[model samples]
Target chain A: MFGIRSDLPLRRDTASRFVVWLVMVLVFMASLAVTVNSYIGVLIDDWNRSVTGTLTVQIPIAAAGDKASAILVNKVLDVLARHPAVAKSEAVPRAKITALLGPWLGNSEAISDLPLPALIDVEMATEGTEAVTAVTASIKAAAPEAVIDDHRVWLNRVMSLAQGFGVVALTIMLLVTGALALTIVFATRASLAEFAQVIDILHVVGAKDGYIAAQFARRALVQGIIGGAAGLALYAPALALVAWLASRVDSEVLPDTALPAAHWLTLAALPLAAGLLAMLTAHITVRRALSAKV
Target chain B: MALGRKKAEEISGDAVGLEAVGLHYDDGPDVLKDVSLSIPQRSFHFLTGPSGAGKTSLLSLMYLAKRPTRGNLKLFGENVTQAKRGRLAAIRRHLGVVFQDFRLLDHMSAFENAALPLRIAGVGEAVVQRNVNELLNWVGLEDCKGAYPAQLSGGQKQRVAIARAVVNRPKLILADEPTGNVDDTIAMRLMQLFVELHKLGASVIIATHNESLVARFPFPRLHLDRGSVSILPPLASSAEFDHDDPRG
Candidate 1:
């Protein structure tokens, strides 16, 4: 459908060449922003899925023995077992806790004797923060030094960070869209000026305004398709490289984000949408200009 | 579709009719003043005038290139004085115009230029190729079929223009100085082409200062002077309207 040959010349004009490159650049940037926004959405979803209804209990060493820390963790575990909101609880192994600290402190024998806190993993059968406050109170009563870490504060911080990136991506997309429309309008108008005599000749030869408009619109649509394809082609490897970079980031606070399949479909369709938009823009611009003429 | 029963009945089958038509660019004196004429279907006429006479303007009006500033005009029994652009374009489909400048697109080959009207009419590709090639061959541009306008000589471009104009077999053919750029032999050949088209039911109008062409062809002449027009019968032996003749 995008294969219509342009009655007007395509490759000779500088304005149309600039139009193609501008479309390519704008579509590339817009796709990146849109997909990044999509990725952030997935990350937020993963955060909600992984962290909700789960709590971590940390019993401080207080410069005491690991045995004492274990005793306090057992007390908190007993409290959690009796609590209605807690479906299950298990003390995290000391070796596992030490290994978790392996990032900051090297796995030397001295690091194991550094008196780290005891940890417990808690899974909740109920929803929301109200049950979290009740469990905190019960655990505090059993062992005054024990604390329940619902991770809500950290989750809230991470959620806001993701939302901020989402907002930036959305803004970038909006700006890129505006820039693309204006660029197309500018290029189309330039073409109209350059080919005004051809237009007059066409009209004399019994061509309707729509016929002339179609000649230009078809060229613009083809240019859009070519530029959009090139842009997306560049974007694919860049996105893969981003995914690779993300894979390199090993962190306790952040989960790996994978763009959803639906998002990939949307990105895949961007070039066609750009093509249609260019076609529509050229059509309307020419129609309006012809309307004002004899 | 009709103004009224009587009004529709009053409409004529002339290819073009103008009554008291006046036209001018914005705020300018009328280029065509109080012009009235009727071109009957399948007839031929030569439009003749001195330099600065309104021959080109009258041809433009007849081809619906511009609307008359004031007056009533009709084409093919339809009132089109102030017709919408779409209606005018639809009417223009039946009109074939050969401009003075031979306005072939510089980017298109002579073959492509000849195929323009048919393409506009949505003719299929096979038909477009077949018809355009035939027309180009007949116009003696077969060797220059794929040559662009800039690559062709003036006479070659004029032939391309004429071929493009008549390719669709329009009901009316309007030519403005069509043979101005060619030798007498080629001009006669081109005029023969128009005569053939007229025989095939096309109303032909040629606007030119070529008195010899007017005298050679038996067609009546519509002579324009100072934005007004008068019908003049062919005078095969007279140069009364010839400015350079200077004979009484």
Candidate 2:
């Protein structure tokens, strides 16, 4: 006789099922967006560290063949090595250069006929664009046919692309949160309307508004937790599939898709936060709706 | 402080009191006008009127569901008209109401519906079980305790409503058409239940148009007509009560 019984329907009706499914999908998308954004941020930082404070020098191949071009490349390397801003410099091997072009130019006997430029790789000790400028002048003076390429310009473009991706990810997360809130609001209002008589009976029986709101809030909290868990459960397999597909590609083409163990904790909190949001939203909604009634 | 406390003690003697209370819907005509009356502690009264005569409206005021548009209302000596929304729950908890339409929660069983008032009052589980079981047994609903509202007959639903109203042993009971849908035997049994409640020091106010039932019991009645109310003595025939005359 003292057992607690639910005044509202306990079944997985259409409206409630729809709300749970919608919340799950929205949370899944939000989690994916946030994870992707974090990965891109890490990639940008890694790329920036590798590309900054570095320069590449290219010497045009002379009609006299590899002997003349090699002389110009060594002269450019000697100039870079003597410069105060240059940390270290080395002449790139012809085999390494050929391998760099191997993806584009096939390893056929005819490939040897094409005249490729000799290259020098340089690492700078001093920071700033001015240091690069000074080293470029020194290399040009030493070898007139040589061209200096400071990677900062290309790095800036890549950083801009990463920033754009971050912005898009953030916007998608915000949209998902908004859609989740609206879906909850709609579902909460519909539940309140459907159970108006039950609510009125509670009211007449001396149950406070908080008591009535708590009933709804508790139901919403349970649904939210279930939906959130379902979304997160599907997320693991989806992430694994993505990592698998990414592993099949060349590492040079794609950034590392594997997330750190610590990042998983953050992703795990998403569903929990969604559940709390649903509970709080339902609490406020039910109270507001009850206050409007007689 | 002593004088104020004495005055409060004196006011606490009344179970329900209204001072020139008036009620209206929006800007429409008054449903109840300048009605002043007091039900002494443990008194029982039948509120009688034709359909649309505002019997339910007057009962609404008594149960704290609706505040009078103009004038003061005191439930168990508390100024409920001036009470805040949060304070209303505390005051309402001391009063029980049986609705005319039998507003039972369809999803809940008869036992759960009967145990609602005690649960709301935060009674302990053991006490709730004991009191609710005994009350259901008295109401002849012990066997149907597991049955939901949809599965119960109209008389059974009415009994569940009554059990809920009295479960908390409230200081006052306000019932609207408590026996309108039941058979004569069940109706007599329900009236006997109200009498038993009154004997336990709870003032009972039952609104009904059943003249035979009114005649069967020696309870005073407050007759309402054209937005006005007049008190009639116990055992007084309703036929002798004039509808047009304010002085009855």
Best by DockQ: 1
Query: Candidate 1 on B91-161: residue-level lDDT in tens?
Result: 78788999899989888989989998888788899999998898888778889998999999999999999
lDDT: worst 10-residue window of model 2 chain A: A1-10
Give the best candidate by TM-score: 2
Task: Write down the TM-score of every candidate.
Answer: 0.85, 0.86
Fnat scores for every prediction? 0.78, 0.60
lDDT of all predictions, in order shown?
Answer: 0.83, 0.82
Write candidate 1's Cα lDDT for A1-294 as tens digits.
356656676566666678778878888998898887887788888888889889988887855676776677777887888899999999888799888888989899998777677788999988888988888888888888777778888889988988999999999888887877788888988888888888887887777889888877887788888888989988989988987887888743446755789888888888888888898888888998898887
Error of 2 at A64 (Å): 11
TM score of chain A per candidate: 0.85, 0.86
Which residue runs of candidate 2 sit more than 4 Å off their true CA positions?
A1-5, A12-14, A59-76, A82-85, A102-116, A126-146, B1-13, B182-189, B216-218, B236-248
Question: Which candidate ranks first by lDDT, i.e. highest?
Answer: 1
Backbone clashes, each candidate: 0, 0
